[model samples]
Target: MGIRLMALALIPMLPHLPFGQSSLSTSPLGIGTVKWGRTEGLKHAPFSLPDDATLHQLLDAAEAAGINVLDSAPAYGLAESRLGSLLASRPNRFHVFTKAGESFSHGASFWDFSESAIRRSVENSLRLLRTDRLDAVTLHCPRHDLSVLSQSDAPAVLSSLKSEGKILLSGFSVMSLDAGLLAVPHFDYLMVAWNPGFLEHQPVIEAAALARKGILLKKVLSSGSFTSVSPAESLRAARNLPGNPVILAGTINPHHLRDNIAALT
Candidate 1:
């Protein structure tokens, strides 16, 4: 659903705007591609990766629907490679946001924030995403340990990539307010979880908004269960959480994608 610019208090990321109209601007909506490539590897996954035809149709739908950002990571099976290949045809269609630090092997996670590790991760992402540059690179750190990310050379590594014009935004996908606050000073964007049932990081999101950093919301639809909540209701609850947030809805179903685009405005 389209996001409105009304009463969006605390942070006027986008000040006054009308309701029922989706903004064509770049900040409000994004697609998370975890299920786009493979579903068997992640927790709570309910679908398998799509074939080429389905993925092509999905991208077509995204383009027709005016969706702008596509979020993916190396940990998301073949998501990066698929995107790299598929998106080459529509290079300017959507912005790409991916991550480093946390990786997967045998469906298990491994974390490394050392300078070299970060560098290798970024380089690999560049190759896999089929781009010399990335829109944003997040430190995929665990929530509880997020506050200590600065101890690693991650910020420096991302900064170097930014300096080389390879990254537009640098950030972290954090799990706690303390970690979110710590990330505010160092990142351009912060990915946090905010849904109807979870509000523990509301303050952290507000803090991020106060700092003028962009916020990307994960699990907005409650892992697609949305429980008994309708998309509009779920989106409303998300708006009530905190921050001038951006929704990252991961879906392979075209109808859901359309519904997701229309729920909030």
Candidate 2:
């Protein structure tokens, strides 16, 4: 039972909606803010971090081009805060997806999954992003910790947050097929690194479709691993997946961003 097949099975029960009707599906493009406001001293610089002014211009350009989703995380130093300030007045213009589970400390990263940690992360993200609620908050790639999404208490906490309208959905960032499979049944979204270099987990795409989970394709450029393939080729390969609609390719260059957006159109 592939994901597309599963969606077909449920189609009759679902309302007759237009294809690409959802805001997410309508645009196969999203902006990743990992380099938005962070200093290069913290992490290895894959590319130069864009300045605040440059980032603001990029956001404005993305919005003008009709890109709606902006992916950020609190772990990215001042990324959430910079994004919050940029989008404070135009929050409704774009869908904001952020993450918990990871935080920055002394030029390094750490992960925590205690219930208190999860709650605090969400609260801090809300404050830093200057938004009352997030479109989605994924558990930033935790190791050996499924309790956040599997334990009996986990559902209560997430459900409470959802019920209170603090978050539209919850999910986990997966690095392996097995992890993705485990998360499929429990999450509403799945953020996975998918690119030419790592195609073995393509099955997870089908799994996401089966679960009706939104698939956020990250590392589509493979972190500069496959520089030979043009951005258009990368975008085409990602879009060719039956159920993938949103792809996030991180780049600090506005010209590159425009080039990537051109591929989607």
**What are the per-residue Cα lDDT tens digits for candidate 1 across 47-133?**
667787777766766665566678898788889999999998897788788999888878688888888898899889999988888
Model 2, runs deviating above 4 Å: 1-26, 39-47, 143-156
TM-score of model 1 (CA atoms):
0.85
- Error in Å for residue 112 of model 2: 0.8
**lDDT comparing candidate 2 with the true structure:** 0.72
Q: State the lDDT of candidate 2 residue by residue for 65-127, as single tens digits.
A: 667778888788888888888887675787888988888767777877667887898999999
Model number with the top lDDT:
1
C-alpha displacement of 241 in model 1, angstroms?
5.8
